[model samples]
Every structure is written in structure tokens, then in C-alpha cells.
Target: MSLAVGAVSSSKNMGFDESKDSEEKSHVSESSKNLPPPSPTPTEEALREGEKYNRQMSETSLYATEEEEDDEERKIELGPQCTLKEQLEKDKDDESLRRWKEQLLGSVDLNSVGETLEPDVKILSLSILSPDRPELLLRIPEAGNPKGLWFTLKEGSRYSLKFSFKVSNNIVSGLKYTNTVWKTGVKVDSTKEMLGTFSPQAEPYTHEMPEETTPSGIFARGSYSAKTKFVDDDNQSYLSINYTFDIKKDWPSTS
Candidate 1:
């Protein structure tokens, strides 16, 4: 009886130990399910590193392409280049234009030129006088005057031309005298030379002609008209007067 009781107790003890062990094992398994995962292998780590490197290289290539495109766009914005042949042709065209202008200016007439008159000045009278015969104040001959009443001057005779002028407001800085002779309404001879320069003067000035000689010889004997031109300080003509006179071979005998 004592041996059988001992054996039964031992069997009970073994069953209790086994049940405890199984419960502990179940708790361990539950705890293990909540734990973190394991570390990656070397192969997986290498694949990840290669993917990052490839992404970085793609971005770098894109940036370099953008820079190259910007440079090309800037080059296109610049204007077309001028070649040496085009520059030479432009210079030749400019030279041709200059020569054409010079030729156009060379064809102008200078002899028959006349300047416009300034209205501020006018000539009052112009007459011829002989110093040798002071009483001979030769005036313009009238149709009703005696047949010999015209101004008769011998060849090589010295005479003075008298002129009176009036200026409205401006000053006369210079004076020019031009003499022209006409026969039968046609100009025969003329003196285009400037006679003298005068100081600045106001209106109502009288200028005496310097002593002059009449043309000599047979060709000088004829009806003639004398014209005198007066120019102002500005080199512009202001007044001109005409006088009729005759050249004779000899003076009339004084009775």
C-alpha cells in the first residue's frame, strides 16, 4: 500500500510540471510576436545604395543639360555677324555717294549771280561831276533840253561820281561800287571789282566817287548808259542807279 501511494504522488507532480512549462512557452511566443524585425542582409543594403546613386546622377545630368541649353539660347539672341566683304561693299557705296554730290555742285553758274536787296537802305541820287569845270554840274538830260545839252566828256577825262543814300535803321559796315556801261539797251562793258570799304555809318550818307578816266579812242564815241551798284556791309546789294552820258572826241569851243 505504501509503495503504490508514493508512485501516484510522483505521477501527479510530473503532470503539474509539464502544464507549467507549456503555459510559459505560450507567453514567450506572444512576446516574440511584438518584437522588432531582423537586420537586412548585405545584398539588400547594396541594392539600396545603388538606387540612391543612380537618382543623384540623373539629377546632375539634368542640371548640366539645362546649362548647355541656356548657353545656346544666348548665342542665338546675338545679332548676325558682319563679314569683311559686306563691310567693304558699304564703304564703296559711301564713296560713290560723296563723288556724286561733288559733281552736282560743280555745275553752278557764278558770273550771272545776283543777290537779293535789303530794303532798309536806298540810294537818293547819283550824278557825275567835273572838278575842272565846277559849274558843270552835269544832270540827267531831258528830251526838251538843247540838242547839245547832254553830258559830253572827252576820252581820258577825269570825273567824280556823287551818290547820296539813306538808311532806315541799320548801319552800313561796308560799301561796294560796280560800274557797268550799256549801249542801245545792251551791256557793253562792266567793272565787277569792289571799289572800297567804308566805316560803319547811319542813314543819310554821301559817298563821293573816286576820280576815274573815261575810255579813249574811236570805239568810245557813242551813246552810253552808266550803272552803279551799292552793296551794304553784309555783302548784299541795296541800291543801283543808271545815268545816260555821251563820250566826245573834243570839248565844244567856248565862245
Candidate 2:
């Protein structure tokens, strides 16, 4: 893995590099790092005192991710699309291209191909993994899930988030995700990571974000709000959601 300061590991079979869709480069840090607060957006700057972000409800959201405003700066160029079958058939006369295509295809099941105009990326689940601790996996609903504090994390513990997803139809390019976290209406953390491009395959791909240590101390424990989004290079959003969670002194007992 390329080890993007704060991203996770992915197998070589996946696209991109350890820094492979490394599956991603991340912008994540604990509050203890004293990351400077995100600059206020123009729209945010114009809000009146009564409507400032600090007092906003979770539904209205708790942070500002400047990604949309600066899309072009972060955008990666994508090439013309070709189905795996078509690509495999093309330049079959060339030995080099054939070998390259073989490596890219990597035992991918040909029958899994589907007829669709655009690639469909389905996020299956999200999990929280920590050394010596049980995995906390969140089942993703097809639509919006009922909003609430779904789980708890032990403050100061090391943990990472993992995702499982499937892609069908055409190839999805620059697959990535962003996560922004807030506490008591103040933005605390944000991240963007590239999972790289992927071919439509029968099996789902799972990516685990690099581990993060939750901030501890008196002020860290409590309820928090988070917004997570999954999107592609073309700016297509597969999912965007607002949910709640908590960091506490101890993990919740399974019993």
C-alpha cells in the first residue's frame, strides 16, 4: 500500500496503488492533533447568528466539507469507457495488451457481466474494527435508515472503518468516499479517500480505512454526528447519509 498518511490497505488485485485503491489517501485525524478548524464557507459566513452551524440540528447536519466547492482541484481524469468483454476482445492480436488485460481481469467471472447504461456500485456494509475487540458491523439499508445513535466506540481506542461493495455493468472510475464527523454541532474530523477504479465483477470489494485513535479526555466522550458519502470521479453519489454515534470511556458490553 502507498500509505497515504491516513488511509488503509487493499490487495493488489484492486486498482490504484498502498497509496493501491492503497484503496485510498485520507484526511483523518483525532482532535488531539489540534487540526485547524475548517474554514467557513461563503454561505456559512452569511448565516445570521440565530442560524449559525453550531446550533443546527443533526438533520441540518453538523459540518462543512469543502469538497463540492473545490471539485475540479481534486478531480482525476477518467478515460473512455469500455466493457471488460469488449476490452478483452480488443487488441487480442497484441501479446502485451493481452497479458495486461489478463492481469487486470484477474480471474474475474465473465458471466457476471450485466447490461446497464451506467455502473452500479452498491455499498453492502460498514464495520468498526479494533485490535482485540469484536467487530461492530453496520448493515446498510437499501434506502435511508432510521436516524439515531447506532453504536459506541471506546474513547482513545484504535479502530478503523471497513466497507463492502459490489459493482455491476460498466467500470466505475475513481471510486472514493468521504466522512465528516461532528460533536455538539462543531466539526471535528473529515476525510476523502480514493478506492481507485473497478471493473464490474461478481464478487464485492471490501476496503478498510486506516485505523484511527479516538480522542480521549473529559471533553471527548459524548454523542456525535457524522455524514458519510460514497461517490465516483464523475461526481455520481451512490449514498449520502447522516447518522449519530458516541465515544465513551468503555465499550458497550455485548451481554
TM-score of each: 0.39, 0.67
- Candidate 1 shows a clash count of 0
TM-score winner:
2
What RMSD does each model have against the real structure?
41.2, 27.8
| lDDT (Cα, tens digit) per residue for candidate 2, span 1-255 | 358633533444345454533233343334436777678775745666546545666545654447654476457666777676776779999999999978876665656664444788998888999995889888676689535777899999999999899998777888889888988888889898999988777789999998889999989999999888888887888988888898899999988
lDDT of each: 0.58, 0.79
**Residue pairs with backbone overlap in model 2:** 1-18, 1-19, 2-18, 2-19, 17-20, 17-22, 18-22, 21-24
User: For candidate 1, lDDT tens digit of each residue in 1-255?
Assistant: 999999989988777677787999999999999999889676987999999999999988775332373355345343343332232234555878646633533332222222222325566665667655553544432322223434677777788778766654222344566777887877777664454433123436677866788788888887787765666444466755566678888654545
Output the lDDT of residue 47, model 2: 68
TM-score, candidate 2, is 0.67
